[model samples]
Target: MDQPVYSAAAPRILIVDSSRNNLAVLARRLGAEGYRVMVAETATTALGELQRVPVDLLIADLALPLMSGTELTRVVRRELAWRDLPVILISGRSEADGVVRALAAGADDVVVKPFHFEVLTARIARLLERSTRVRQLAADNATLDERVVRRAIELGEARDRLKALEAELGRVG
Candidate 1:
């Protein structure tokens, strides 16, 4: 069987923007570059998308309609399954405090509005690569843990058998 093409395989992303025009622009830009863009106009809808499908990356506008992007990022970071999920937050407000707050709130990176598409794509690629590496490491760790448990069980069984043999010799003596 042929393996799936990683580059052709759309990297799924959830984009949260209030303006349909903005969403359209971002979705087109990413989709053109082989991303399967999923747009959500509100935080509630974005969370719903997350429940339905696993996203490789999240690009959220900080000034969402009902809930701020910061809150969404926090929720994703706190959630057990999505905690290590990569996020890039965008905002028109570029004040020092705003940028600092976004970063501190667990945003992998914050991009100010009127940003370059290439820059955004580069950041997304880097974040996704890092996430893949982390996931691989986690899987390796789980495998090692299982091996350790199995070895311990085997050692216990061997020790018990040895004890039984010793008891049999004692009876013979």
Candidate 2:
């Protein structure tokens, strides 16, 4: 299936799974979809990679060799730089409770095993769009804050000038 091309820089995604087969398949699929894919066999490796590189999104298996996906999600959410990063948990367990727990632990979305590639791709696109919007809004807010500060300074100077003019008028009169 043909995927939409993102801007000049392709979005980067980190996928963590203990299963080698799952890692190979997902890496191939996401790479074909125009994403720069990074794969890790364990949560520890994933976290290490995150420190060295900037990842736009994370896709982790719920069952990791050491740490669970939910725990990883919580850690990511706690980090200031990664707090806003989008995470999707993929689990072989079809239980609804697992999905609920993953979301509660701060996963942006959960996908059951044997999920369609198309569906996963769509979800990734939606999350990336939302993240982009949030970043843009933050930048706009910073610019607005600078403008407000500048205006306040100008107003204060004007007020001082007005007071000085009033004092001069009193002396001349």
Candidate 3:
């Protein structure tokens, strides 16, 4: 575990579960955990929410209506392939195979049903911290790349000027 930790801002988490009670409980609890929480009862609504909002992490149920969380994860992975969006798929205790499949489909973690809230929150925090760090690193890398390009251009211009001066010295000498 690389153990990415300690983000500067509270992360926004998106929860997708078909059960209204589950959604409500998760939203309220995560909100209290110093996170901005958004809930969607179905994968489609979750997709819409994803499009409109910038979510740090996603917690989705594996057995969603119409579209399973595995499928949702695949779609999200395809669409936001470049981004470091972490996904956790909650599965029924019976679905070991689905958990494996969901992981293959790009879910970062899996929580079997009847999970401890503490465990879920810990996972959320870790993923959010990692995402924040990855984004920051990407930004820093872009800045460094820009600086390198600028320096290369300046060096090229100086090399050209040096060559012209050498040619003039050759003719004068």
**Per-residue accuracy of model 2 over 37-114 as CA lDDT, tens digit each:** 999999999999999999999999999987999999999999999999999999997999999999999999999988
For every candidate in turn, the CA RMSD to the true structure comes to 4.0, 2.5, 5.4
In order, the Cα lDDT scores of the candidates are 0.89, 0.95, 0.88
TM-score of each prediction: 0.92, 0.91, 0.90
Model 3, position 77: C-alpha lDDT score: 91
Q: lDDT tens string, model 1, 41-80?
A: 9989999999899988999998887788998998888888
Candidate 3 to truth, TM: 0.90
Clashing residue pairs found in predicted model 2: none
Candidate 2's clash total is 0
Question: Candidate 3's C-alpha lDDT?
Answer: 0.88
CA shift at 12, candidate 3, in angstroms?
0.7
Over 101-137, each residue of candidate 3 has an lDDT whose tens digit, in order, gives 9999999999998989999988987887888889999
Q: List the candidates ranked by TM-score, beginning with the highest.
A: 1, 2, 3
Give the CA lDDT, 0 to 100, for residue 167 in model 3. Answer: 100
Better of 2 and 3 by TM-score: 2
